[model samples]
Target chain A: MNALWILAVNEYLDGLRNRWVAAAIMLLGGTALALLLVGSAPTGTVGAGALEISVVSLTSLSVYLVPLIALLLSFDALVGEFERGTMLLLLTYPVARWQVVLGKFFGHMMILLTAVAVGYGAAALFTVLVSDSGTAGWQAYLTMMSSSLLLGAAFIALGYLISVLVRERSTAAGAAVVLWLIVVVLYDLALLGVLLADHAQQIGPGLFSALMLASPTDTYRILNLTAFDSVGQAAGIAGVAARSGFAVSLLLGLMTLWVVVPLATTMALFQRREL
Target chain B: MVNAAAVEKVIDVAGAVKRYGDKTVVRDVDLSVRAGEHMVLIGHNGAGKTTLMKLMLGLTRPSAGRVRVLGADPATAGAGRRRALGYLPESVAFHSAMKGREVLAFYARLKGIAPAECRSIFEQVGLDRAADRPVRTYSKGMRQRLGLAQAMLGKPQLLFLDEPTSGLDPSLRRHFYGLIDTLSRSGTTSLTSSHSLNEVEARADRIAIMKMGAIVACGTQAELSRQAGLPIVVRLGVRSGSGARVAESLAAMGKIHRRDEHRIDLFCLGASKMVVLRQIAALGEVVEDVDVMPPRLDDIYSHYMENVQPQ
Candidate 1:
């Protein structure tokens, strides 16, 4: 158990000191700053609740940034140990092989948790100070930030699954980045384009909603919009989409599934691997 | 608990074979070790010593035959057997993220040493000062010391050390052999593999000379010399200009090798001892001092290794 926890702590430290973690935090911080300074009250725009805007923006921020960081954090988990010959030390211990896998999974998760706390915490603090919004917006922003952390953790585990599945760190890193891009960035883009073209009229009710929940990032977006109905009213289509089925409870369930399933897969693969 | 009498066979390897693709790394080989003995395995590079150790540890499986470590087949050895044996791998790296103390305690826990003994064990290993620092900050020798400490865990009955003191300096190397000797006296069986053949003869009670996946020779140092049909050379130092004349007379009278001007190596042959002494006295007055052994292991090893090549 000490071995397990130590490994986890090391994984967490990797995230704290890693350049990728800094980049993700900077990207999120910069986006929050830009949103506060640039995105502002339009002429004659009424009913702009600070609560609604902050919630919507944070949801967007975490969905875009957290998964990217989480993916980067987890992709090199086992390969690095194997390449550097530290695996021999771990193996000499009488600890069962399964413990090693689960321990590593927990360690990488702690790192993901730390990253979300630091990056999202900074964003929230910045928004509260700069945004002219009232207490209601701050409350909504906090809620969005908390849920986004949950969503990010799910994908970080997903990256761990990929790392264990691939034998090389470089390949795992590439696969993780590609996975983040496809799932977080392009999945919504493709869905939005398809919905606008013809699928929006042709699809069954809640079909797009069902497809969107397939992605934890999309589920996070949906949860955010629905949590702040005022934002749902303004953004029109996307706002309404966010307000629907993927509420907090639904997103929680999906995110939990994301965390467990990939972590389990990684453990299984790790147990059977030669190293 | 095992009966003390049954410990004569510390390690039993029979018909062991390992193959990677078309290459047979280790072929059918049988070797055995006994209790309270310091056994050294010596071979040239690519001789499969490392592979054999890995097989014994169950880090790699044998394609054929059985390896019984401490009387239980390593492939089928339970947790109990694994706990009794301490293994030091060739490249024993540490978890850099962990502090030295943390690493020691962690390994101690795995070895199932009671928590109360952890501090003493750490001190015994000479890692008390740098214990709090992360292993990433440790020097290479420090890391090797830590590896030694880990192998010393559980007071291992059968210690398998692969290049155990590779990075250690002379003083530490002396300290290491002292530790091994102490362990030997305590009745802990050890099979130490090293490339330094000359070095092992000093520490090992018995040396198993290996070449190309087979044991070429196995016996005590004296037994090996006798097997190689060579004499154990004793150096006799004499005084002044008479040393050279004494050396020549001794050589003419009996079997001897001239090492230097003042020194002559005496190899007793099929002759009476008084004859050699009389021959020495005939040349000049005998020297007051006598050095019995003059580093005979190297000469014997080179003789045997060069003479016999394992198929």
Candidate 2:
């Protein structure tokens, strides 16, 4: 096996053993199931489709939850190894610095993918079993799941960037939480506040779409809620989707950029790092 | 592998300087190790011993100068070249959830050794019985042994061990050094850093004493002792009430240190050792026993460190 594969496999196994990962997986799975079963009660009464309603709810859930989970899983990846003295021993082996960073990136990405698949996959299965939404519903749900994974990849990359930038595990953790708050919670709130204050003048559609694409969660929101007619109309983003003029390909490209740029920067910084 | 006819330089560090910002961790350090040589680095904490070892292993690039391990710059060496080097950090830590056997196998695969090779290495490091146990369950000494087991994998031509015996018991320490000895005999060049001077004194072929990021002294025990100019101590066990008499008689020969009423230690240069011993023999009945102590590595280390310290 390649050395990078070995390191990645070890990282994946190590991540599985962590109590926090287990808890996060459970939390996501349980919340996703609950949202599908209990939170979808209003869909039946309101005459809205169950899959459409759950899509909206689950997208919001992912926006808040997936990035947090990704950050939590990866914040300590690099700095923790350095603090624990494993990085020194690891670097001594016949492995390149880029291999280490990429290995860890893939490993953490796999963990997040597994969590999202099992957590959100089970919920999507439940929604499909009970609902009669047909192909369009399944399409939107699949897009949500895949785009959720992409959003997670972006955050995991950002977490690695934080891991390499900081000197201590505690510092990386603190930076990760702050980053999560900024991208997930505060960025949207601040943007909404800006849009609300500029209601008279109105933010331009082009500038508005660019601003939304700045945060991975917003891009994820736009992708899942705007990709389809039924889900987009139900989620109240159809007008924003029509005005934003973002193709599925373009939004996906932006998310890919989010994953690659931070990872590339992390590799570059880690290469020159003293440890 | 044990080609005694042709000597191979495993590690060559020339004028290597490592700086973290303005503070220099390793400065103008030049060192070389030959195949089958067991070199021990002794220094105080923060003496750049670990940093120097990192440079030799190519774990970190020197800010200036050059470091070549196995005739290639460690910082730029390819995977094949790096596969020939092994290192055990001062504090060895592994994934706590991993079984000892699994951890060794992973490292073995990274070093391009067959997974089957891990079994023998486990036995070699005395970690066979605990191979299936999780690393979290192992004690500190067990972890150290596990680290050694990994470092010894693939029969690395050059091994860099930083405080390899930190938490080992006396017997395990002996076993560890014996393993190094066995590997050395097989032409594996080993560079080990240690604070346990007395234990490493007998095993190390050459000792390099580092202080404040520089090699203040480097040589075999005898050579270092000669360079330090430290005297050998001869202690005499005198009969009761004869301590004062022996002290006065020994005072004329050389400097005398009264250990207690029953003993007096004589400090004499190497040349005057026999002359002092002959004088002590003439006072035969006054002295019951005599212990001629040569300068130990600890003494030589302290002497060199003291001389290097600014007044």
Candidate 3:
């Protein structure tokens, strides 16, 4: 267990010290500050709502940026060590190979989680100051923000799985970027296209919900919508008052699946990679 | 100090063979280093020395045959068995992010070396002062020294050092081997694989030489030289203008070659070197030195590899 902690601490230090974390913080903080400044320009509830939308923006950013950060942090986890020849150094120790993998995985996750916590905290504080959404709004925003970080943890583990499953870092990086695009952007766009094409017909959003639940990004989207008082589903589910509760249930189930599945895949793939 | 304890088999290999698909890299090697004897294994490049080292460490498994270290097969030696062994692999690399002290402390923890005793292991390997500095800043020799530091933990009864002194400056090489000698004296048996010909001659209690994956030679340097019929050695030094004269005159006694300026070398053949020693005394001051002994490992190696290889 101490060995596992050592690996985790080492990996956590590596990510925290990484230049990417600095860049992510700079990028995420700049955007949040811009949103706050734009909303404070003397407007009413609609304008206030526009600023509150940063909560939604946080989800979107969490979806896209979290996976990108994850891939950056982990896609070269093993191969980088191997390429640099440090793997030979570690192998001489008595620790099992799995400990090394698990340690690095959790270590990187901790780094991303810290970033998400800081970014979401800033976004939430900005939401509170710029909007008149009150205590209920603040609770909703906090829940969504914390869960977004959990969602990031899941994606980072997924990047770790890709890293171990692939041998070449460039190949892993390319594949992970494509995977992030498919999960965060293209999948939603494709779902939107499917939803539009099905508008004249009647197939229920079952397939869409199931497919969206398959991507952690979509899972975060569902969680934010359900947790923050149906903000995301206002257009799609508000008029259908009777079905709103079911959407909430779908959100919880999807988030649960997102957290469980990727973590399981990462752990299992890590078990098999040599060094 | 390492406690030898009772006699035990530290490394035991049985019919180990490794194949790289169609090419067999190591073929049926059966060898062992017992608990208190210095064993040296020497072979040329591409002679399976590196592969053999890997197999012993469980970094690679043999396609056939068994390897047991400290009564446990390394391929399956739960972490406990590994904790008991210290190995210095050739071309050892270190984590750049870890300072030398951090790396040593980490390995010491893994090896179950008591924390109180860990600092001394670093001291023993002469890395105590630089332990806190990151390994990336270390040179090749420093890294090799760090490798030795890590392997010196636990003071295990057995050690496998693959060219442990390869990068050490000659003074440190002698110092390092002196440490090895002290370890063996205090009861740590070791097998050092090296290409530096004189190292085995100077230190190994028994030497094993490999040719094409087979143990072609094993024993002390003197025994092997005697078996190969290497002649007795004689070195003579002249002041000036007499080396060539001494060389020609010494040719009457046996095979003579000018080893260097002011030095005449003769191979004693069919007679004691005392006969040539008497004549060379008349020829010059014999100012340098003359010693009559069996051929050195350098002479025996060339005679064996160059002239005695084929039937």
Question: Using DockQ as the measure, which candidate wins?
Answer: 2
Off by over 4 Å in 2: A19-22, A42-53, A134-136, B1-7, B233-267, B272-292, B309-311
Q: B1-311, model 2: which lDDT tens digit per residue?
A: 42342247777789999999899999899898887799999999999999998887777889999887777787777766778878889889998888999889888888888999898888888889999999999998899999999989988888889999887889988898899889988988889998879998878899998889999889999888988889899988999998988898889777888978897888888778888988889988878999999998778888888887521
Error of 1 at B225 (Å): 4.1
lDDT per residue (tens digit) for residues B1-311 in model 3: 22343246677888888888789877788887777889888877777777787777776778899987666676666655566567887777866767888777767766666667768877887888888888889888889888888877888767778888786788889878887888889888888888788866778887777666656666888778777777787766677776776777667787878877787778875256567667867775645676667677777666655664411
Could you give candidate 1's per-residue lDDT for residues B1-311 as a string of tens digits? 66564477878899898887778877887888888778888777777888888778766678898887777776545544577778777878877767877777667776678656667766766778888888889887788878878788778888889888887898888777787787778888988898886668668888877777777788888778777876545567877566766666666544677776677778864224466656555654567456544337777777767898766
Question: Is 1 or 3 the stronger prediction by TM-score?
Answer: 3
Compare candidates 1 and 2 on DockQ and give the better one: 2
TM-score, per-candidate, Cα-based: 0.75, 0.90, 0.80
Candidate 1 has an lDDT of: 0.72
- Quick one: best lDDT, which candidate? 2
User: How well is each residue in A172-267 modelled by candidate 1, as lDDT tens digits?
Assistant: 888988898899889999988888897439875588778888888877777667656666654454545654645467677887898888878877
Model 3, runs deviating above 4 Å: A17-53, A134-139, A191-204, A233-275, B1-7, B112-118, B211-214, B226-229, B234-290, B299-311
Tens digit per residue, CA lDDT, model 2, A38-120: 77565644344667778899999999999998898889989998998888888888898899998988788778778887887
Q: List the residue pairs that clash in candidate 2.
A: none
TM-score of chain B of each: 0.84, 0.90, 0.79
